[model samples]
Target: MVALTGTMGEIPPGGTSREFGTAYFDGAEWWAVIRGKPIMARWLDPIQPLQGGKIVVDFTTDGKGLSSALVIGGYTDQPRPSTGIAQEVIPAGLATTIVFIGSDGVTYTTDRFIGSYSPGDPIYLTWDAATPTIIGKIQSQATPPPAPPPPPPPAVVTGTETLLVTASDTWGVGGWGRWAKSQNGGEYVYSGFWAGQTLTGSWFYGAPRPALQGKTITAIKFWIPAREPVGSNNAAATIHICAHTSSARPGGDVARVVGPFDVVVDPGFQGGYVNLPLTFGPTLAAGGGISIAGDPYIGFLSRLKDPQVGKLIMDWSA
Candidate 1:
């Protein structure tokens, strides 16, 4: 560890060590302080993003340095009701250093919460600017391909090619699932993949994007297949599906369900077929065409989890 003395705190060696609340390096050496008192030094780890813009962060600390539990609180637009903003009180003075993590990566060293006078209550560290040690040997990895270019246009304009969707491993774990298009087809597209059990019965997707202000679609239909080995969570197989329209851009989407059709049945795992009734509205067209799509993609939430599999068969004849 390259030791140094600075205004932050006492520094220590760097790496992927969980030395939270323990000695850490802040350009120079300076001990970590808890509640204005010097305690074991610990460094805060950066946070990572989850689906839907959520995040998670963590840090470890040696329990011996602080007097009381480590306080964790922050300010948010959704302020806490009366009493006080909810704070996490981690037991302090542990044999192993304690760690603190957050959903966002904003640096905060001040008390970001509002509470009555309580000496031990946790608040942001205003006295000392939070010192985050530079550590971890992270390698920059390549980003996955963009949501497979929207599903390609249908072979011909038989009826209305209203809906098209595709999904997969790249679009997070819960690949698209439970898609429905109207019997009066116009045009549509969606794409994605599944990796686990997911309930996407309510997810909506489409093509005649929001840009298509107002238009009317005639009808739409999908011939999605499900097999015995592929209907539920503990199924014997997995599946992928995509859909789209005749617009300049294609449409794509995907989704899955775990089933043998059991209590824990898969949505598209059985060999037969399913008819997801679809409803449409005036905004079918994005101020241009007449088409709409809903539940374009839905399914498993995590790649580690099991996902449903099957083919999507669409028809405009209805």
Candidate 2:
């Protein structure tokens, strides 16, 4: 048995492979008596090595018993260690040692040795007793996804509407001379003779009701009758429908003359009335009055004794 005292010598920084101690056993014929029996022995003092020291023990049948070799201050094939610093400070006395292990299984020692470290400071180290290295720092963070694209703009909406306006003479009684009736009471006439005088006439203006407010007038239609029986006195004349601001007859003008439509007396009289349609660009507002006027020779058919003078048809949109 060996009794060890004092330091066996400081483990070198790199390492040294050398035999430290040895043991022996007698293998002659006298030892055969105890070969099959169990033998146990104990050491009075335990072996302790400084940091980085590696001790290896071997047994050989060639006569050597327990032999030990020391690899002083060496690295092992182990994974490198990484940690955040707890504190970092210059050493007041002996400098501390730290080590680092590379991914290629090579150990590296750091040059700097501090007494302390700090939290959040990144540390890369190895199992070797080399100086610990500070690589960087770490911080916690969170990032949100990009905001969704803005919603598409709302779509525009548009449509169309129509207004049909018919003239009425119900506002008064005796001014019905503008309207005429056949002597036989067959059908009413407009701008025709009644009781021997030729009637030149104007009809009451037609305007949009409250329901048709804010609409636009797009077209106008005139329904006038051809001279009866295709007579020779039937002449061509100009017809007009004017727009005004007031409902009263011949009020302030909004659109002075909407039309001066020419009409020819139908020589055949195949149909009693003809429809004259006039279209306008864009449109006109529904805020005003519409009145009908014409040359004396042009006449419109009227309803019998109904007090309605003329029909003014309007096509509109809103």
Candidate 3:
């Protein structure tokens, strides 16, 4: 069916009162199809079959909104089937006229714009001798091919190092937090080492020193300092503070630091020691412990005996 628009005298007097397009008709339905908008066509009377050439088609509207019309111009003398439905054998090539009226009171005709049509391709048609509307989908075209298979997903890579301290030093999951007296550092295994042996250590609280409250510490004191590599063969180290007395959460970057410590490779230096001052910011809580849990082999500290102490300071709201 077609749609009509515009006001009455809208059509210029001598100018083209209105413009219409081609039409199409399926075996059972009639439609007036246009390119962009809808055109309206009303049938004042039933369509009567013509004996020879042309047929008279009449229809009218208030002319409020007038667009192009879909005129059903050909196939007036075609015989109707026993069911009284308009029937015609559409030609193999060239534009053809196919017309039919739907139960909705709209006439549809095929203008056969392009020479031939396969199934699925839409064919334009119009009914009411006026502008024809695109009725429905053509039944001749083949169905579309199935969609392509989805692409494969990406792969995940896993490593073996256990002393995994994330790259940040803030205070929560990615930051530093409060430490408790009896805390066990996180569990990790040494996979590969640039240098030095793999050893495990946990975090324990030292005798509470008032000056240590609210300050941040990067090193913990061992009952006995262990031998470790220095400079070239230094071991990677990490530190974690427990949020709860029994829990050791991995601290951010600010929680751990590494430097050269003297190893007892030479016996002459009776119990040589390496100490790194646990000074960075004011981040540790008073009476809370410090933990130095990482690879502690010989010669790992750059600056020996500098003494690392835990300190606590203020942090902005997370």
Candidate 4:
């Protein structure tokens, strides 16, 4: 059987030209008959089997164009199928050609057509011998599952706290008023030994105040009075702040040691109590009481006090 199919431009208002052809026939045998009159015909062939072929013609109309139609009328020596349809599965990324004999004793072909596709893609092609066209459609397959939801963000912990002077103790002193002094109008622990007198005096210790527990101390501020005893030139003292395991006086330094910050009493008792600020490393634990030790130089104030009224600032997540 022969088949013919092709696209055509829109017919003009007056008329338009169209053509068709096949490779099976010689040019001399082709003819165009209109109203019982023989008209000249053009044959574009000598084409290979299953290859495209064509015939050319220009039509003249009386202000009316031809209607869309398909005409199949031919005689062949060999018998052909009356009607035929075929289906084929084409894989992705492959170009293929489809050829089949039609009911009109003509061989039809869809020369090398490619359907660019992704992995696992399949194209369903349906060929109709009457239309002489192979229509292709992508097969329906399961859609990939949606990407797994992004992992949840890590949990965050946040809080706030404060470090306050909980409890204060004076080292090397028996009675309260004896080894204590008033500084900035607040009672503070004092070391009341003059310079070179066995170097004896009092030290101060501070722990978290009541109602403020589990607070991390970030910084501390205190006051110390430096006095120049008679006949002494610049009397200096070294203050040490150590982190202890407990609130008692003799606990070991489990957390850290701050410093031996020096306090100088110039000649003639030139300096008053100086304000000292110490920032802790990574914030001291409130459970570990901070120990304060003082080592005084000759003529340095021994009876002076170290204030326990310092701010113990802490931080927590809200």
Give the TM-scores of the predictions, in the order they appear. 0.19, 0.32, 0.18, 0.32
Ranking by lDDT: 4, 2, 3, 1
**Model 4, range 1-318, lDDT digits (tens) per residue?**
111111223445556445434322344554443333334443334312221222234443343433332223322345434332222333434445555334343445554334433333323333332233434424465333234477798665444444444444343333322332323323343333443322222233345443334433333443333443433244344445444444433432233345434544445543343433334423244345444444443322332233224333444321
Q: How close is candidate 3 to the true structure, as a TM-score?
A: 0.18
Candidate 1 whole-model C-alpha lDDT, 0 to 1: 0.27
State how far residue 167 of model 2 sits from its true place (Å). 5.1
| Model 2, span 54-165: residue lDDT tens | 2233211222233233222223355344533323343345654444333333444454633344422334442323344545433443122234477897664333333322
Candidate 1: residue 133 lDDT (0-100): 23
> What order do candidates take by TM-score, descending?
2, 4, 1, 3
For candidate 4, the C-alpha RMSD (Å) to the true structure equals: 25.7
Tell me the tens digit of each residue's lDDT in model 1 across 233-291. Answer: 35433233222222332233222321212112254443344443223223223311111
Better structure of 2 and 3 per TM-score: 2
Cα lDDT tens digits, model 3, 2-96, are 23334334554333333444343445444444443333443224552222323222233434443333243434344322111222425545556
- Span of 10 residues, lowest total lDDT, candidate 4: 1-10
Q: lDDT of model 4 at residue 143? A: 37
